[model samples]
Target chain A: MAEMAASGESPEILFWVGCAGSFDDRYKAVTQAFVKILNKVGVSFAVLGPEEACTGDPARRAGNEFLFQMQAVANIQVMNGYNVKKVVTACPHCFNTIKNEYPALGGEYEVIHHSQFLQQLINEGKVALKGGGEFKGKKITFHDSCYLGRANDVYEAPREVIKALDVELVEMKRCRTKGLCCGAGGAQMFKEPEEGKKDINIERTEEALSTGASAIAVGCPFCLTMMSDGVKNKEREHDVKVYDLAEMIAKDMGI
Target chain B: MSILPQLIFLLVFAVAGYILYKRVSYLRRNIFLGHKEDRNDMKEQRWKTMVLVALGQKKMFKRLGPAFLHLLIYVAFIVINLEVLEFIIDGLSGQHRIFAPFLGGVYAVAMNIFEFLAIAVLVSCFAFLIRRNIMKVDRLAMKELKGWPALDANLILIIEIVLMFAILTMNATDQILAERGVDKYLAVEGLFFSGLIQPLFQGMSEGALIFLERFAWWFHIVGILAFAIYVTYSKHLHIFLAFPNTWYSNLQPKGEMKNMSEVTNEVNMMLGIQTETSNDPPAEIGRFGAKDVNDLSWVNIMNAYSCTECGRCTAECPANITGKKLSPRKIMMDVRDRAEEVGKSIDSGGPGLEDGKSLLGDYTTKEEINACTSCNACVEACPVNIDPLSIILQMRRYVAMEESGSPAQWNAMFQNMETSFSPWKFAPTDRFNWADQLKNEEAK
Candidate 1:
């Protein structure tokens, strides 16, 4: 945000590189993949870089409303100072909090999840889906993230992006409104499970595996982590691969 | 009219009225334990919600079978109470069939309709009893429904069935008495269900028929009074509370969380968006989130009182399905129980506010609260629109801010968010490094 203000030039959109995108080793690949897609399409977008803060989704969800408001206020102040109007984020938590919660704190922006944004770029003929991609005709199932699918009601955009890859899309028994959580929401990603009969991620991953798909597609970073960990736990990491929707699109483009 | 029976009737009625008043007052005081919140906005929408949800049984019909059965009891319970007004007047004035002379044929029509509903109520109560006991529905068998809740459900169903039977038997015996030309016995016909059972009293002595008539009459009226007071103590309280609970329901979008203005004001002051006045004293920071019943909003207390303990929320909860400790029904039950405890302490002139126990520690544990995913499934599944998530969030606030008892991993995340502006130890300058890598790869 500061870089844009000092340069006296504005990008068409601001890419919100959330905490996981910025630092988590596994999700950093997703960040790189989404960036490649943006560059390939020649879309003008800038990152907050050192000026960005966590959107406080985890803090607020974990019951620290005070900390959440503080973090939200700081980020809103910086973004407002830059006159930032549009934002696109790969993380649904950030997408949800900023799009829904930030407006009450005086920070309003036209926020879009990366899946929807990618679909829009394709719809506008800005990005082309080349035939014979790596996932062409491959069986891929999508796991709906609680925040993205249930909370925000964006079920079709990510699936549409997968369809654009020329891949056969399968679905788990519990999809869309009835989709089970990946057990990583509500800040549970930062803590240990509190003594359950079975881990929720394992149960959800079992449903994904039952679809006989070779790859799982995800829209949110938290779902990616949980689904990937579930695949690893089942020792099917060799058989099944978990790819974020952006990564599959980037790989298919040969970027 | 005999003065002796009239005086006896007055004494019995006063005792029941006193008991009913005491229980209702107790409930009112317990509900007021929480802090005030204004849910009076959007009056038109609130009225529509109450009518559709509580009156029309809109949400209940999601499952057709249970909805049909519950509607039978709900409709009968409401319509049959109209008969109670006639009973009160007849019992006090020593009159038999007082409305019979005024309405003439309409009186028999109304009584016929009441008889049919009485049978429907009896059948529905039996079906519900079997569902709770013999069939053993899975939701009814959850851990939260054990002991008192389980027994309370069976007890109420049995009482309702008995009350309906009393009505039928009273009408049947009165028909027999009228046939024999007994005094003060109106020869009313078209009694439907009761008329079918009139043969059981045939060939019996007149004195025995009159005795049975008076017994069933007194039992029906007195039983209704007891049921009224008992409802205040049981989960059946939803019969009365579901209306107002639906009225004060949250009208915001399901995904939107209500922002705490107190925290917002502090944030605005810190951000220099709103300057604090020099005359204003430093704001005293209270406990961050709710710690007890008194800290929660009044709507939350109302939600607690309005919970039906049906376990539908728990049945749909992903956490419960995955075997987590969290049961949304249990959370509401615990809140109501704690509120009752605090209210009773106050009635006894003891330390009510400082009961040395709280809704957080003594009742609900952190394990259950943490197990929640905040998915809003429970809130959506509730027929009365009770938002268990609100209470869960507030209790979690207490755990996070007041006790600082969150897991070490969460504390690390909090620390990371504090210094690095992210939930990681990396510097924010490296945030866009992924884009830089993409540019280099493309240049190749």
Candidate 2:
């Protein structure tokens, strides 16, 4: 990480802190904490400034391609000049856009979601975790993000790492590769959900609740917001908590 | 049977049939097989489309009116051909002019009408050729070939006209000297062909005219045989493929999406396409995701071969008119090319693989598929009745179900479908919240 930062040859991941991660400093801190762990293991990484503009995926979904492209090209050029060989982001949307969409417009780079990167780290023994935590013996079901699960096919790593950490990985009726969306993709976060039968995130949260887990564990920062809101709207906040994977992982590491 | 004549006909057509098969199959193999897509639902659509589409000409009125007019001539050709068959069998039964009188008496007018249509068909086909080649006029419905496509297409068109004209000439000449009196339409037959035919026969008496009629009979038969071969190689290839494509079209569901099944023997299992793995598919599949072209399946080629390129499919496509960069006609053409490519590879000792191409791709593009809004316009507009929408939707299924090649908006749509039975992906609270129990229950 330091070598790339100094020489400027290696591409910085430009990990967008995102609204959710920024608001929940604990998640942010843990995400940063994990980077330190990765750094110690000699896995190279970096962060874009905290105020880096939103990828505007939400704006694009609101039928505003101009805004989306503006945000996307700006980030792409920043990363392009850096010789970015790859980018890893905690957000599935950012990871996918940087990997799949940006390249279509002539920006090419190997982009992977953080779950994928984290899973690679864990699988390679570059990162390890201790299991004991404040939320011990609590059954939690993981909510797969559309960007990560369906879009990117990072089905196993999050569960594998979570399993290693001693979380009672409860399975929802719909989980893994075919997991539901959190209603947060397509710049949906910036606009009101289409007037429909139900909120997409809440529907997913109910499935997680149906799993009988004490908490809904999630991978995407946006999913964390949606599911947490779902718990509150459904008056289940007292019964089931929403935690980003980082927060749970940090707690297990005695952070 | 006169082994000599039969052998000559068989020999002519067999060589011709092989060439025709090679050409059509080449188009089926090379042209359609250029790209691949995932169309798992196409297995059933194969039957539905073939029956309702290729044979029924469901979209003929919706598109391809002029082509359909030409097709009507072709159909009349087939019907009138039964009369020709009746004569050949009569000849096989050792009679040349057996039905000559009855045909002259009863169906002469019908024969004359068919002849007129055949002539009109020839004219239209010629005009069409001029438009396609010289004028470079192209239907959004059919493939735009190379600037003046190889001589094969023009030759095929010429052959069709010549064969029809041969029938016209032979029929007219035979009627002139037949025991059934010369046809009234043969005005000045003597002034035109009498002198033309006389020089060919030295010291010919009136009885020699019978021999001339026999010669014309053989010539016309040869023309038919040649036409048979011409059709094999040309877009007229649709003559054969359309029937079967229509007969077996609705083999699968179009609107309802079947669940994805895990087949253990991936080695033996078939997918939507049977062709290339899209080294390059359409722009739609290419943009978001496309694995390879080999995954499209057998049915897409059936669509290509059966399509007459009547512009109906495109005329009805909502996406095409709404400024979306999509044309159902182009999609069919691409499918045909990609299909032909794959089929050719298989014939050339390449594996006839039906596997692993993305239904949605950066090649064919998510934008094009997403532009559909599933309006069924193209399906409704097909002439040989192609169901491109079924294939398009199945592409969506592959992306949504298998590859996650979906656009950003669909990500939420799938999420909604997962949470709620409806595509709305509704909240659980509101999912049933809109419902109220039957209050009266028949006044109970």
Candidate 3:
């Protein structure tokens, strides 16, 4: 944001590298993959770098509305200072909160989740998949993130991106509107599971495993983490791989 | 036809009316214990909601079998109450069948209809009893339904059956007396179901028949009054509250969370968008969210009263299905129970209870609330539109802001968010590191 202000010009889009994309070791690969695609396609984009905040989704959801508003206001001020308009994020939590919740806080932008942004790019012929390279004929199942699927109603964008990979996309029985949570939504990622018969992620992962897919594709970083953990719990990490849509796209593109 | 009978009738009616009035006033007072909120906007939509959901039973039909049975009882309960007006007049005037002479044939038609509804009510009540006791539907068998909730359901069914039988018996014996050409019997026709039961009075003499008829009449009237008073205390309060509850249902889009204006004002002030008024007194920035029923919005407290305890919300909850301790039905039950406890304490003592117990610790556990995902499934499944999520959020607010009792990892995340502008401990300067690597690859 300071760079844009110093240059006296804003980029075409602002890439919101959310917390997981910014810091988590595994999800950083996803961030790099998506960034590679954007750079290769020559889409003008800039990052907030030190200016970006967590979007306060977890704070608001954990019942600290005061903390959430504080965080949200700070971010909004920085973005508005930079005259930012459009935003693309790899995290559905950021996508949902920014697109839906931030407007009421006086920060409105044409926010798109990375899957939807990538699909738009592919449709416009900016990014091509090199004849469905690498993932051709592989059995892949897509895990729907709750915020993206049930909350915001964007079930197709990620699937469409996966379809571009030319993989045989298998679906869990509880996909789309009936999709189960990865046990990390509503700030549950920040807390230990209360007493229950089984962890929700384990149950959701079992459904994905039941499909007999060799790989599980995800759109949100939180789902990626939960699904990865579930696969490891079953000792099937060696058998099945988990990849974000961007990672799979970058791999297929050989970028 | 004596003044003595009239005096007895007035005394019984006054006692029942007074009890019902006291209960209603108590409920109103208890609900007002919560903070005020304005749900008065969207008048047209509110009316539509009342008619469609409460009157039309829109949400009830998701399960066809139970829906039809419920409709039978619901319709009977409503249609039978129309006869209560006639009961009032007859009791006060010491007259039998006062409207019969005026309407003549139409009176018989109405009686036939009432008799049919009485039979429907009886049959439906019996079916409900079997479902509650014998079949034991999963929603009805939740742990919260143990003891009084279980007995309350069965007792209501039994009372309905008894009340309907009393109506039938009174009508049946009245028909037999009219056959014997007794004065004031009126020889009313087309009694339908009651006519069928008239044979049970075949061997009785006039005086015995008169005694049985009066006994049934008193039982039916008195039972109706007692049921009215009992309803205020039961989950069956939904019978009265469903209309107002549905009328005031949240009209906002399901995904939109309610914004805190106080926080927004503070934010705006920080952003230089608004200036604070200098002359205003120091504002009481009380606890951030709800710690007790008094801190909650009045609509939330009313929602507690409107819960049917049918466990439909719990049945549809993902957390409950996945074996979490969170039960939306139980949450509402706990709120109502806590409200009752607080209300009773205040009634005995003064304005506030000296008891250290609160709605949070004594009634609901933190584990149950934390298990919730805020999925809105419970909100969607509620027949009366009770929002358990709102109450959960409020209680969680108390936990997070006032108590500072969030789990350890949450505290870490909160600290990270406070300093780093993200949930991770990494400095925000590295936020664009991933994008920079892409440019580095391009340079190579």
Candidate 4:
């Protein structure tokens, strides 16, 4: 981002909060801090319009191919019209679709899920980290989102982000590749839940709780909501808190 | 001087000729019977399947014994038709004997050979009728055994066998008349029955024997002509539909059935399924890919028209064998019927395939398509090789991509894919955990 900015032309990493991040203020605050860092480094960025609607990912899944194409094409044109090619989003589904599905519809761009983009900054030492605020005592558990892990084949960046924060990253039995769903995909957020054998969010939340972590740190807006809900509903509200990865990192960096 | 007999002979042969022409034309143009398919590699398949299957009639003898039965009948039908022409021409032309340029004697010997073979062919057809109609064999289920009129099959068999016998009887009668000095054998002199009939003929007169000779010839000719016309209208229609259907058959495997991807627009979907109440959108409208039978691709209709009702498709389909409600053959028939029905509503100009609606909902429902393992068994096993799997999958793609009506799990997964770049719904920050195990190795 800094290199793109340092060049004579204008360069901005379009920071997309996505629907999931919009509802979580902590995520918003941390994400804004990252934007502040970019600005301080003289790198430019723009957030999506607050009213930015969905990119039609849920509709595509429901066999609404028409809706998916329209949403995808419209979104791509919007992004391109800004002359922006680089994007960062907290939601992996948004990130993957913009990066992968959009290409099928002739919408191509360089997209990075935020965890990945942030890890690169840390590895390059481009962003300043606090020297005294070490996460030397906290045990943190990481949750992998389907979009980031399976869709984009990103599996290491988030762990590296937490390791940089010096937090002990723990795992639930259903971590990494075999991770269970949080029951919030496929536009299920818009529709009422079906009577499944068990609430999927409750099951996933318990899996995280079982890890005995002080906090369940996540990367997606939907996973953040579901896991936090899972923590509250399981009465583990006092023991485990769900923090978006950005919130965890920005705080560990003393920003 | 009798005109009745001669009239019948001319009329029947003409009708047979007419049917032969119409059936060939219908099979060719309607069913894509002779289309030269442009496809990927299959030079050998073209040779063995395209050339060999129709000409060699290899399917007839796949089971040596049963193959022998059909082969005998098929060969006999072709042979006997030769004499049918001779019988008609001689009866109408005031000729006492069938005209053969080189070998009158050779023709007689062939008639005798044809007579014995006719009996064998008749028996085989009769057995097929009984097995298919009376016994209701499961093997023939793919073929519509109904509307087949087993009686017509019997009638054809009986006519062939009886006509040959009548030839024998008429010859016997002629021999007796000649022996009585009633008629002349001209070629073969002093034949047996001619002598016995002479004593009685001395009492009767020459006019009577001559009249009897004329009667036998007319009866033989009239019978052949009547049967010829009947065969044309019948399922012996395959006599025509099979050749081109075999030649122009779909070359693709069932699974890859091709149809344009129905790319549905997102803004339109948020509006929901279109109805009469739908206010027109501000922009150009997009309707469903296919709205009714006329909306279906012409290839679908062709599949239906080309069916010879051989039942080979159904016999090999695992779904039909497993007692599923799906029958690929029935699907073809229904598609044909619906296309015709929908065609009635279309302009005479004939609409394109995309303009017609699919019959997928009526016969092969979404459940059926989903249930299919996408196995290409049906396409491979088909004698004509229509690819049903492609049609099934295309429908699924339309439903999934356009309708957005899939199970919620996949929707959730898709949502995950859109946001997280993977199908499993998860936190974007945690996307990199799969690399954790490989990290140490990468460092080395």
Q: Which candidate's TM-score is highest?
A: 1
For every candidate in turn, the CA RMSD to the true structure comes to 3.4, 20.8, 4.1, 17.1
Q: Is candidate 1 or candidate 3 better by lDDT?
A: 1
Model 2 C-alpha lDDT per residue in residues A1-255, reported as the tens digit of each score = 334567754644545444334334334544554554555566655555422445545433433333345555555555665666776677766666666666644468776766667667777766666556665667878887766664555678788767867768899865653355566554455435533446666677778888898988787777777898889998989989887666566566554
Q: Considering TM-score, where higher is better, how would the candidates rank from best to worst?
A: 1, 3, 4, 2
lDDT of 4 by residue, B1-444 (tens): 778756766676677678757654543344331122344356566656755666577654434655677777778778877876666566677555555445667755775566556667767877766766678768553343455434555566667666655555455556556465553343434334333334543454456656655565556666665565565444344554456545655553211223123343444344352423336554442444333333344454455665545555566543454445556666666655555444443435555334444566655565544433333444544545455544454454556655765566656656655665333455545532333333453477
Q: How do the residues A1-255 of candidate 3 rate in per-residue lDDT, one tens digit apiece?
A: 577669787799999988888888899999899888888899888888867878998888888887788888888888888888999999988888888888888889999999999999989988878765878989999998878876677889999998888889999976875677788888888778888888888988999999999999999888899999999999999989999999988887788
**Mind giving the per-residue lDDT tens digits that candidate 3 earns over B1-444?**
468978888999999999999999999998998888899999999999999999999988877888898898898888888888888899899888899999999999998988998998888888888888889898998888999989888888999999999999999999999999998888887788998988899799999999999999999999999999999989899999999999989886444567776677776676576545567764566667877888788899999999989887888676887799999999999889989998998888854545787888889998898888776667767888889988898888889988998778878888888888787677888876776666676789
lDDT of 3 at B174: 93
Q: What's chain A's TM-score in each predicted model?
A: 0.98, 0.85, 0.98, 0.88
Candidate 4 regions with alpha-carbon error over 4 angstroms: A1-255, B2-4, B13-48, B59-65, B141-236, B252-255, B259-299, B339-370, B390-444
Q: How well is candidate 2 docked (DockQ)?
A: 0.01
Worst 10 residues of 4 chain B by lDDT: B253-262
At residue B64, candidate 1 shows an lDDT of 91
lDDT of 1 by residue, B58-168 (tens): 989877988998998888888888888899899899998888989899999989988999998888889988888999998889988889999999999999999999999
Which residue runs of candidate 2 sit more than 4 Å off their true CA positions?
A1-255, B1-7, B13-59, B62-72, B86-98, B101-104, B107-114, B123-157, B175-219, B251-254, B263-294, B351-367, B398-403, B412-444
> What are the per-residue Cα lDDT tens digits for candidate 1 across A1-255?
566667898989999989889888889999898888888889888888867889999988888887898899999988998889999999989999999899998899999999999999878878788958889999999988878876788889999899998899999887876677888888888888888889988998999999999999998888999999999999999999999989998888888
For candidate 1 chain A, which ten residues in a row score worst on lDDT?
A1-10
Best by DockQ: 1
TM-scores, all candidates, are 0.89, 0.46, 0.86, 0.48
Q: Is 2 or 4 the stronger prediction by DockQ?
A: 4
